[model samples]
Target: MSDTPTEKPSNRPSPVIVLVAPQMGENIGMVARAMANFGLSELRLVAPRDGWPNDKATAAASRATHVVEAAAVFDDLRAAIADLNFVFATTARERDGFKPVRGPVEAARTLRAQAAGGYRAGILFGREKFGLDNDEISLADEIVTFPVDPAYASLNVAQAVLLMAYEWRKAGLERETDIPFTGPQTVAAPKEELHGLFGHLEAALDTRGYFRPLAKKAKMVDKVRAVLTRPGFTMGEIKVLRGIVSSLDYFSPKEPRGAGYPLRKAEVDKQAHPARRAEDAGEGSDD
Candidate 1:
């Protein structure tokens, strides 16, 4: 073997930051600075307030002018994320379940893990004043939020970017985990694992009579399958849910033979016969 030191693998994403209608040229520059601090080099401007290629931004970006000079301008958010495999947004206020919100550290961890799978992921920061609008949030796979004091939860755009970038960098150096979706070098769950998870979920639901009303059975199953497949469930989650099926099946008593046997009998009696079963008929039936 050649004694050359093996090149360490790079965990960095393409990491195009989409700033949607950002205010203040200095803030944009500061964002560039933060990006450089964490080894990120791409910036995409989506209709900035002060205009791109601004001198103020260059001054703030300081020695990181390479990021500023290489910045790309877009008319809207959709164009910015068109070619990316995964997109994440940073927002402060809650937007009524518009997207799944994760803390900064966790979101960064997720980004690095996803990037290891060779995805082109982008982190989007919205306008300074109103932040990302509902339409913009909907464009992202997940939204990342910072944990601040409830009474005073104000974080500047640059600060949020710095925090996310720092966490992502840290995650790249951590040990591997059993969670296939969460390790720096692991890929997303394969199609087979996902299919198995769906089958297990449907079986569990069937056992619980969730697919009630024969008319709606097919439609309901389709809808449920659509949802579980959307976020792209991971191998680890599939394993966990499969375990759930075994646990539920083990405890589901069919013949009344465990600690819960008497309670099960009472439930069965009530459901099977609401009335006392007419005393004369009960006596004759038993005989």
Candidate 2:
């Protein structure tokens, strides 16, 4: 391995994630992980439950030690976002007072613009069980609400942080690249090759009396063709399927059928339901 140590990017401007009266240590660590995923680094906690410098939080953070280590603790919301120029409070429910509400994407764009003007921006998240109270929300410049189900709008603290972080990163992107296909590169088989394979398989099945009941033979054949044509098989795939059909045709045991063999209904029913034959024979003997 190379001797170079992994370096974190410091070029982009990221918003400060403020957790107000957060309850669990695990949630703090998970929030750190989510922040790390979308390139957000700064973390501020206001009155976290179970105390600070928690081992559970550290463990749950996994590889996001940088976020957990640099986390700043504050006594209240105002102290946590004292230096920020703009603050957004996330809430699921509507409050009594009128406040400008923005979705995650809009909030991200606004934060980006504010940061470009050399001003620090932060987002406030509430407690897990009860979200931000009316008093705490009044401190924010704008309200941010997720467009989720009205009946069940509550989101986990870490999940809310992740969604906002993802939007922030996405809004900053110039363009996105198409997903690369990793499997073997093969072109679709020619029409002639596909037709030959279909004919070969159908011929083998016909010899085994698979297309029964002359009236339904056309429909059954069409269904079989539909299944085979759905995948748009490649030349290599078609060859493999042809080989499998050839092997089955050669190795399968075939009973000799006399010339001009009549199609019997009883034989067809017995083949369809083998167990019913015994019951039918017993009933016939009883009669």
- Candidate 2: lDDT of 64? 97
lDDT of 2 by residue, 236-279 (tens): 89999999999978886645422124448888788788678877
lDDT of 1 by residue, 52-157 (tens): 6799999999899999999999888889889999999888788788568899778876787677788889998887777888888888999888888889777888
Best-performing candidate as measured by TM-score = 2
Model 2 per-residue lDDT at 116: 73
Per-model lDDT:
0.78, 0.86
Poorest 10 consecutive residues by lDDT, candidate 1: 174-183
Candidate 1: TM-score? 0.57
Model 2 alpha-carbon miss at residue 149, Å: 2.8
The residue pairs in collision within model 1 are none
Clashes of 2: 0
Displacement of the residue 74 alpha carbon in candidate 2, Å? 2.2
